[model samples]
Target: MTDFYTVRVHHRQKGTDYTLKVPDNRYILQTAENQGADLPFACRNGACTSCAVRILSGEVHQPEAMGLSPDLRQQGYALLCVSYARSDLEVETQDEDEVYELQFGRYFGKGKVRFGLPLDED
Candidate 1:
């Protein structure tokens, strides 16, 4: 088993590729359809190539990278969402969309938004 830290991926598709322990936390592309503290993206199947990015360093495991071309694959590119941490790896994701941090509220509704632009009224 391996421990995974909540890492902060730099830009949408720009970052480092340092080795990480196996069984590390999965990757969630900033462009993934489902966005958390991570980035946001479209089709996660790897067919769209919207989440493709260069790997500055580190390694990754992609069980199902459908459209990753040989040239692109040879260039150290990867789909952030479908890939998993194999052994402590680093990657680049500068083109990814930004996902603002969320405010977790207790069951009793104690938490609230911390910061960002204000909302508009209807």
Candidate 2:
């Protein structure tokens, strides 16, 4: 038997709300999209932060969410593309840029660019 959970989503930027009955095994974002919910997403394989959300309540299992760090996931951040609800859920969509910065901001502006190909001198 498939267990379904009530998933409530608050889209911060769009000022919209979506309430969906999502199966425990289904990906929340995909299910929402199928039901005509306008959720943000890019790289549906969980390689990007476009579909990130902050878990306001409930629990989710996101073993395949490679875009987020363990610490971030522990802190209630989830990539919706690969997350499955473990309980009735309430989540707020995140700003892509903001989440991206939080995930990888440490690497930005820390590297020096090398111009052209370097030739080794003997």
Candidate 3:
């Protein structure tokens, strides 16, 4: 039998909460979208943090969450696009840029660009 879990998502930007019945065999984001949750996502390949969330409760199995660093994962960050429910779960959607900065800020933090302004060469 496929294990099903209740996954609650707190969408911070929209100030909405979505409750979903997720199965251990499926990724959370896909199920969520199918259920009309209208969540944010980009590059649904687990290589980006556009669908990042912070686990508020319960467990998840996300062996393919390559977008998250181990430290971030240890701190309860998860990429819903590649995560499967392991138990009843609660998560809060994260700002993609914040997660990206946390994940790769060290390597790409040096460049800043202003809109409509030409970047300095050299």
Candidate 4:
């Protein structure tokens, strides 16, 4: 028998909430979208933070979510595009820029730019 879990999502920016019956084997975001929920996503393969969410309760398995660091994941962050519900779950949509910043803000403005092509150096 296939197991199903209740997935509740709070879209903070849109001030909306969605409740979905998600299969344990299925990706949460995709299932929600298939059911007509308007969730944000980009690079659905889990390479970006556009679909990032904060797990308010319960757990998810996101082995393919490469966009998030281990620390972030441990801190309850998840990339919904690649996350599978592991239990009845509650997640809050995060601002894309905010999550991106938390994920990579340390590297911003820290590296020197080599503006010109290496072969065209003056």
Candidate 5:
């Protein structure tokens, strides 16, 4: 049988509860997305620590943290993009700051962006 991990998310803002089931090698952020839940995330390859958070409980493995700083990792901080839940876990989102608010969307529903400023041509 395939192994799966369960996670319970306690939203700090909406006061909502979300439960998710993820495969053993899958990241928590993917699991949240699968359940139609939105957690903050960027640079989904761990090249940036933009998706870093505190692991309130459970175990996780980070293969490529792209210099998150050992001090931060020792303090229970984790980069959700490259981290996989070793067991049932709880994590804090980094979107509560006034400067960087997190708004997530379904992976399939992501909008496209066109580079460069608009130019007049007719």
Candidate 6:
């Protein structure tokens, strides 16, 4: 028997709040859609931050959330598309760009670009 946890989500962009009964074994985003919650998502494979959220309370397990860094995870960020509820949870949707910047901004536009490659001929 699967244990069910109460999942509360605050969609900051849409200014909406949803409360759902999520099973411990099922992905939260999938279960939310199944329960008629209109949440945002892009890649369902946990490779993107489109479904990112910040955990306000409770625990979530997202082993496949490659989009989220270990430090971010430690800071309570989760990718809902690949996350499972461990306990009753309350989470607020995150700004994807903000999360992206925090996760990878340092790696972007850092050094001088060489534009003399074959594909970069201008």
Tell me the TM-score of each prediction against the true structure: 0.53, 0.86, 0.85, 0.87, 0.67, 0.87
Which regions in candidate 2 have their CA more than 4 angstroms from the true location?
Answer: 109-122
lDDT of each: 0.49, 0.85, 0.86, 0.85, 0.65, 0.86
Error of 3 at 49 (Å): 0.4
RMSD of each: 15.5, 7.3, 7.1, 6.8, 11.6, 7.0
Query: Which residue segments of model 3 deviate by more than 4 Å?
Result: 109-122
> Whole-model lDDT, candidate 1?
0.49
- Per-residue lDDT tens digits for candidate 4, residues 1-122, read 77999999999999999999999999999999998899999899988789999999999999998777777889999999999999999999987577778755655465522331112112
TM-score quality measure for candidate 3: 0.85
- Single out the weakest 10-residue window by summed lDDT for candidate 1: 98-107
Model 5 spans > 4 angstroms off: 95-122
Clashing residue pairs, backbone N/CA/C < 3 A, model 6? none
Model 6, residue 54: distance off in Å is 0.3
- In candidate 4, position 58 carries an lDDT of 99
Off by over 4 Å in 4: 111-122
Per-residue lDDT tens digits for candidate 6, residues 19-105, read: 999999999999999999998889999877888999999999899987777878999999999999999999999885777877667
Q: Output the TM-score of candidate 6.
A: 0.87
Indicate the residue-level lDDT of 86 in model 5. 86
lDDT of 4 at 24: 91
- 89: Cα error in model 5, Å: 0.8
- The TM-score of candidate 1 is 0.53
Tens-place lDDT per residue, model 3, 1-122, is 99899999999999999999998999999999999998988999888789999999999889998767777888999999999999999999997588887755654545543341223334
